[model samples]
Target: MLDCFHDECGVAAVYGNPEAANHVYLALYAQQHRGQESAGIASCFPGDDFIIRKGQGLVSEIFDQSQLALLKGTIAVGHNRYSTSGKAILENAQPFVIQYRYGRLALAHNGNLVNSDELRAMLEHRGAIFRTTNDSEVLLHLIAHCNEPDFISVLRSVMSQVRGAFSIVLSDGERVYGLRDALGIRPLVLGELEEGFVMASETCALDLIGARFIREIAPGELLIIDGKGYESVQLLPKLPRTAHCIFEHIYFARPDSYLFGHWVHDVRKEMGRQLARESHIEADVVIPVPDSGIIATLGYSQESGIPFELGLIRNHYVGRTFIEPKQSIRHFGVKIKLNPVKSILDGKRVVVIDDSIVRGTTSRKIIKMIRDAGASEVHLRIASPPTICPCFYGVDTPTRSELIAHNHTVEQICTYVTADSLAYLSHEGMFNAAGGGGETFCSACFDGKYPVEFSGMDT
Candidate 1:
């Protein structure tokens, strides 16, 4: 099957305790699936100085035992990133720490800034030299240039100008700061530990590090945790509505995470049930495209009264071929990643349930594999609607021209995937699967109705 763009960006931070850096590292490890392009950790030493180590690689590859041992501090922030706003490079890896008038700040940010290009231009005209191409650098520059006597006031001034989804964590030698956008387009939650307060993009990270779950950080909230104890300030009142990303329930988040007051795993399975009801496939066996689709496939199997089988086995040890560093090697990466369970599929009618189809290359390959495994008929059912448009907030989908759904009809997509039948969960179905009622969500990736405006300066 063809590959999809890797999930991008995860942030974790801790305030209090000398082992904060090590804790943040482990927290980021739990969120490694969210981003695999690069990893980094920055900590504020108790004496008000900082130590940072970041590089272009997975969390495990970049931070060895020795590296973690060296970073001793009381406050720290960590990040794992996939290049969404800029080309992949070590310089773009975060936590983006810089020396400023108010002292020094280390920042690890999740989500894209829709107005960053314009803000960056304004900063450049005023003589701000940028160190990285990613929009996160704009945050540090803004804070550095703010003339406000207090750092928090400067942070408020800077955050006010930033538009779009962002869940950011900053460390300024003593306290840890967590800020979320007014629209709340991305997920950010708070946790408590014996040593301090913890913040992460997902609850899975907190559970990984033995942190107790705390309430979610509200939209437009600025949280500060330090020796004086934890406190929150409403930088802006909660807007009349929230724009939480719809895809987080579909694919981005770890199943263990609790988001939007529901378990991610349960939500995905419900989406599959809804898709099954909408599609109503008749097949000898239902199969999932391993990993992401397992829960959905199970739900589909239950709803359709069809037996579920593991007809496709994934090689857990196959490091993502996307990181092979050579285009030629990457082209054949999927062959090593998945193997068809021939015995189970031989002479059977198969219905494959997947999360969604992006470019369609992967689904086509999967269908061909099932056919080759002797399946008499193959049907494809997607849990979410066709991703016809790219996501500007955080997801890394293709441009319109590259999206198979953007240019083709459902029947055409079926022919392309060589399936006996093809069906997708309707937009309304997805909304219902996520949760019922008239609650609003950001469906920009599915319907292209962005909740925020884009400046269109970055790829």
Candidate 2:
């Protein structure tokens, strides 16, 4: 299996700015990797209802000058979505907007709620209608139906009933709000424009728009920004332990982004350094799988004193669909994305570095491709521990049965991938590399020790 890994969503919001919609556009553009299934933006002029433009495609494909022009506002919220709780269809594209009894509200969310299916069932029993399958829409429904005096009370009431990771940004036709889960499993950062504030899923989005890096939105904090200014209300108490998703550093986040108080690139480099310390070997050269593997490979090269080469070249321009030949070709799907550099790999004892190996079939194909390019031997080194559990906190991970390492040993995976040797970074080394990035970071995918309690979620 060619593994599929995706972080479900990213959110960006702006308040009290003349070009708020434009800022959100750039933020979503910078975070395009978070979700490619759909892109959307919601904007509203002061005292006006929201104007939302949403569709299925990359951010660039969905948004342009005319579309952005139509969304005129000083308050805006935007979303890039790869669904974990819903289908990947135009109907589920977000910043989900609705006109409720209280007022016009729009929401864009990152991360998943574990109890959403149950909540949807209960709400449906009570005659609540749902427009989309997205779990994020559940929060809006709860808030609208609550018998609360104010918005903060509604948040206080609903946030306790729902469980799991969520970093949300919403616009209420006037003010913008940012909310993070009690466990902080997903990241949300606050930034500053000259005239207003920006809330985004990562600091990289802030950087793209020349916004000053502020601080991460604290766990369980609800930040509200309005005409007078912004204020923080503790919607829920912080958990005894934080559950920041460790995979964000391992693969999901852009290398340039900073999450959980650590620079993602630097953390990945340290992960490679630690892996090298644990699994160094005699090799003529070290090569990476490309893209996500590049930074970690640099650290592996430095730590192991092995020369690093771009032995595998990636075709970044390849589209989601391309015409293939009528005749069948082996590994055609992988070959279209990555090709080996024979001159760099010929007669070499190569060490290949990657973030992680999911199903191992792709690694097998890659190793064979390297051998076809005349490599003498291929050794695989992973930057993190073997994944044995499925992620229920917004990451799109395979089922336990589908993960190669769930039941297979390191040696078994090595044989399956046709590598001369295989090794994985230790859990101790991973946390040590992060310099205690999170005292309670979630590593359920590696160890099967999920922080949040759930039923029938193992799959």
| Candidate achieving the largest lDDT | 2
What stretches of model 1 exceed 4 Å from their correct place?
322-331, 436-439, 455-459
Model 2, range 342-452, lDDT digits (tens) per residue?
999999999999899988888999999999999999999999999888999998888989999999999999999999999999999999887663456988898888888
Best by TM-score: 2
Global fold similarity of model 1 (TM-score):
0.95
The CA root-mean-square deviation of candidate 2, after full C-alpha superposition on the true structure, stands at 1.2
**Least accurate stretch of 10 residues (summed lDDT) in model 2?**
1-10
Candidate 2: regions farther than 4 A off = none
Q: lDDT of all the models against the reference? A: 0.85, 0.91
RMSD of each: 2.4, 1.2
Worst 10 residues of 1 by lDDT: 322-331
- Candidate 1, residues 1-459: lDDT per residue as tens digits? 245645879999998866898889999999998899999999866557788999988899999989988787888899999888877999999998887666778899999988889999999999999878999999888888888878778888999988878999988887888989997888889999898889999999999889999878888999998888789999866788888888888888999999977899998988888888998956899999988889999989888899999999988887655455455643255557778999889999999988888888888888888898899999999988887778888777788788888889999999988999999999898888787422468887677777887666223
lDDT of 2: 0.91
Clashes of 1: 1
